[model samples]
Target: MLVTLREILEQAEQGNFAVGSFNSPTLESVRAVTEAAEELQSPIILSHAEVHNDIIPIEIIGPIFIQFAKQASVPVVVHLDHGSNLNIIKKAIDIGFTSVMIDASHMEYEDNIRIVQEVVDYAHKHNVSVEAELGMMTSSGIGGEETQGGEHHATQEAEDYYTDPLIAKDFVQKTEIDALAASFGTVHGIYVQEPNLDIKRLKAIYENIGRPVVMHGGSGLEIEDYVNVIQSGVRKINYYSYAAKAGAQAVKEYIQQNQNLFYHDYTVVAKQAIKEDVKRAMKIFMNNGY
Candidate 1:
């Protein structure tokens, strides 16, 4: 059934497990994630990043996502990821997105709160949930263009971008956001160095803010780290990069194995590979000895 982000995240918090917020920009991805969630009986979030407007225009994909959510057997949240402007966010909301993210972390602190507050007010009136980013992260994954690159920045310098626990509390209070995406040690795409999450800082943010904490750049982490982050208070995890990579690799392998395959055959291979990858992710998020 279609649900809001708040409802899903609240369930995640109670169960002490993170929900896989998969970036479902393509039809194959939407199918893979929704099917995987239903099979696992897991509440999943299907997200479309605003930056992917070129890949598939939101106008075309928005309603398709809503329809998929409504048809899914398990709870589903159709969310707008990394909505950099209010105009795009508003458009997603108008298109029936259950949740919208206002990513103003790159702006000044006061400006970030102001913009997020405006979005929260508007989104809440429509019975939608609002998520806001509090700290900056490297742009290395899909929808990562025009942002700071992780390869160009050193791992040690990442601490400079980590979210302040106290400030996160204040920002959530001022913006009245339903969820907070805070950066402690993860980047958007792949990790240049080993993935290390600041569990202490994450716990502090969760305790101070008293709301569901979201972790962007959720791909590329070890299974142990995924469990640790959930235990430390991460309720929503935005994962992509690797799952998409798996699908791309599957297509290449299929073409290599078969001399003459139709376009539909390739889509079948890609969709199945992505579905399996999503299922693995959902099991890990279950945090139930999977």
Candidate 2:
């Protein structure tokens, strides 16, 4: 069953469980995630980031994602994660994406709003859901051509780096985004240190925003943290880097252990590794199917 973010998340808000948004780095990863979701009978999201287009172009992968979402037994949302290009956003919608994130988190506040509002207006007209981020989300210094060579801007003031509840209210009202990806203390990629979530801040945003709260940078958080944030009212969570790493490492280990295995055989092992990891994530998130 193909479903929108709003369709899946309204149930999450009522049931108090977070839906895992796993990024599809390859068509294989999407296949793995879909299998896991069907086996668990859980509603799942498959995402492809704008930054990863160099590795897996959205146009090449969007149709496959749409096909998987439509054919899946459990609910699925085909989402474009961290969309920076409006043209790509429009293309993904035309390619049949159920949801998109018009990420202008790096832009100035009003500029971010302007960019997101334009996307929302266009996406809404086509009946597609939109997600927009507020505040600055930091990186744990991993992934991509752009960031691989640069130093990560560490959080000097936690509040300065994270979303403000007041601005969240206004951002939602102005952008009309279906979901808000709120940055608390979590950063993208792997955790460089002990990850501590600002549960109070998450609670404050939930109390004020009156919209589905999304937790990105969810790869390294402790299981308890997922429980805390979902309870604090986060309906959707993004998990990617961990799955990417798991599949790669699994293939590497498999090939090394079985030196005679064919090159194509690695993909077979990789999909299973990705599938099991995705299933574990879905279980950890505890989706009680609505």
Candidate 3:
């Protein structure tokens, strides 16, 4: 059933687990995410990033997302991830997204608060949930292109972009967002080195904000890290890079073994591979494996 982000996060908080939010830019991705969620009996946030407009327009993808969410057996939240501006966010809202994220983290503190507050006001009136980012989650470019989405693949220092607990408290109160995406040590895309997450900072932010905390660049963390973050107060995790890479790897292996491969042939392999990858991730996010 289609549900709001707030509803899913509330359940996560009560259950002491985190819900996985996966970026679904294609039909195969939509199928894989919803299918995995249904099979695992896990609530999922099926997201589409504004940065993916070049790959596929929101006008084209939005209804597809809603359709899948409506048909899924498990609760599904259709979310706009890293929405760059009001125009894109408004479009998603009009297209029936249950949740929208206003990403103005690159702006000054006041500006971020102003933009996000504006969105929260508009979205709340429509009964949609809002998520806003405070800190700058840096990306890693050590390997190939870090991610196809807006996150990950930067050479900047992660510590420099970590969120302050006090400021996080202020931002939440100012914006009135349903959730806050705070940065600590995690980056977007594949990791070049092992991530040393600041569980202390995360706990502080959670305690101070008194709302659900979102962790972006959530693709490559260790199982222990997942458990710690969920315990600390993470209710939502945005994960994509690793699952996308897993699908790509599967297609590569299929091509190596077969000749005369058609588009459907390898896309099927990729969809199943992505489904399995997402299932594993959802299990970890449930916070019961450790």
> Candidate 2 has which clashing residue pairs, if any?
none
Q: For model 3, give the 10-residue run with minimal summed lDDT.
A: 143-152
Measured by TM-score, how close is model 3 to the native structure? Answer: 0.95
Q: What does candidate 2's lDDT look like per residue over 1-290, in tens digits?
A: 88898889888887888899988878788889999999988899989888788888998888989889899999999999888889999999999999999888888889999999999999999889999998877777774213421123564765677889998999999988899999888777877788778999999998988999998888777778887888898899898878877888999899778858786788888899989888888998884333
Writing each residue's lDDT as its tens digit, candidate 1 over 1-290 gives: 89999998888877899899998788998999988999999899999988788889999999999999999898999999988878889999999999999888888999898988899999999999999988787654343333431122443477888899999999988888999999888877756668778899999999999999999889878899998889888999998888888898999999999997799998889999999998998899996432
**Candidate 2 lDDT score at position 57:** 92
Task: Work out how many backbone clashes candidate 1 has.
Answer: 1
Candidate 1 residue 154 Cα shift, in angstroms, is: 5.0
Best of the two (1, 3) by lDDT: 3
Candidate 3, position 276, lDDT: 99
10 residues in a row with least lDDT, candidate 1: 143-152
lDDT (C-alpha, whole model) for all candidates: 0.86, 0.85, 0.88
Candidate 2, which ten residues in sequence have the lowest lDDT sum? 143-152
lDDT of 2: 0.85
lDDT of 3 by residue, 182-208 (tens): 998888767888998999999999999
